[model samples]
Target: MIDIQFRREDSNIMSVEMSGHAEAGPYGYDIVCAAVSALSIGTVNSLSEIAEIPVEVVSANDSGGYLKFTLPTDLTQKQMETGQILMKSLYLSLKSTEEEYNEYLRINSLDGK
Candidate 1:
């Protein structure tokens, strides 16, 4: 199973952390993992390319399957709004995937809001 966590602060998402493998299929054929990787990497790229927000991202170099994305502290007001939109889009997309593949994917919001 894959565990995806969303961390929020002051009603805004502060970071997103994803770990674990979605053993829904064999290596190179896990659709759930692919969906999640695409969403996460795409969000990072969009934050840099579209929102012009330089976020801090960390990924596991080992085999544990871990990725964390955190927003930078110097974003302008507009950038913050745009970044939120992109992040929310990612969250909703992951939620939809979780709805379909509940056995393979799990999403938790730390803020519970």
Candidate 2:
């Protein structure tokens, strides 16, 4: 299964970490993996190109299972707003996927509580 963890601070997303394989299908034909990858990479692109914010991204160098990004703390007000929108969109998309593929995907939130 794919495990995704979203971290938040002050009610704003601070970082995200995704790991594990969805193995719902063959290696090249896992729709669950594809959906999560597309949503995540698209969100990263939007954050950099559309929101104009710099995020710290890390991925497994020789593997296919892990991805993570940390939002910068020094974003401008407008950037912060746009980033939140993009992040929320990602969360919703992932949530929808989780609802359909509960056996293969999971989403969790860490609010520093």
Candidate 3:
């Protein structure tokens, strides 16, 4: 199962962490994992590439099935908005995924109002 946690700060997303595999199918054929990966990686890319604000803390371990990212403190208003939009989009996508693949995924929102 995939354990995904969204850390919030004052109702805003502060960070995101995900671990484990969906195991919905074979390694190359797990649609759940692929969808999750696309959301997470796409969020990062959008924040950095499109928003021009690079996330200072990002880690990934393919073999261990882990990925984490934290928003930087110095982002400008536009960048922050961009990041939040992408993250919220991710949250919605993951929520939908959870609804469809509840057996292979778990999502938790932590420490944010």
Q: Pick the candidate with the highest lDDT.
A: 2
Candidate 2 segments exceeding 4 Å error: 110-113
Better of 1 and 3 by TM-score: 1
Candidates sorted by TM-score, descending order?
Answer: 2, 1, 3
- Local accuracy of candidate 2 as per-residue lDDT tens digits, 32-95: 9999999999999999999999889999979879999989999999999999999999999999
For each candidate, give its TM-score against the true structure: 0.93, 0.96, 0.90
User: Which candidate gets the maximum TM-score versus the true structure?
Assistant: 2
- State the displacement of the C-alpha of residue 80, model 1, in Å, after optimal TM-score superposition: 0.2
For model 2, the run of ten residues with the poorest summed lDDT: 104-113
State the lDDT of candidate 1 residue by residue for 1-113, as single tens digits.
Answer: 88888988786787899999999899899999999989999999999899998889899977858999999877899999999999899999999999999999999775743
Residue 17 of model 1, lDDT score? 92
What candidate 3 gets wrong by more than 4 Å, as runs, is 62-64, 110-113
lDDT of 2: 0.92
Please, what is the whole-model Cα lDDT of each candidate in the order they appear? 0.89, 0.92, 0.84
Superposing all C-alpha atoms, what RMSD in Å does each candidate have to the true structure?
1.6, 1.1, 1.7
lDDT of 3: 0.84
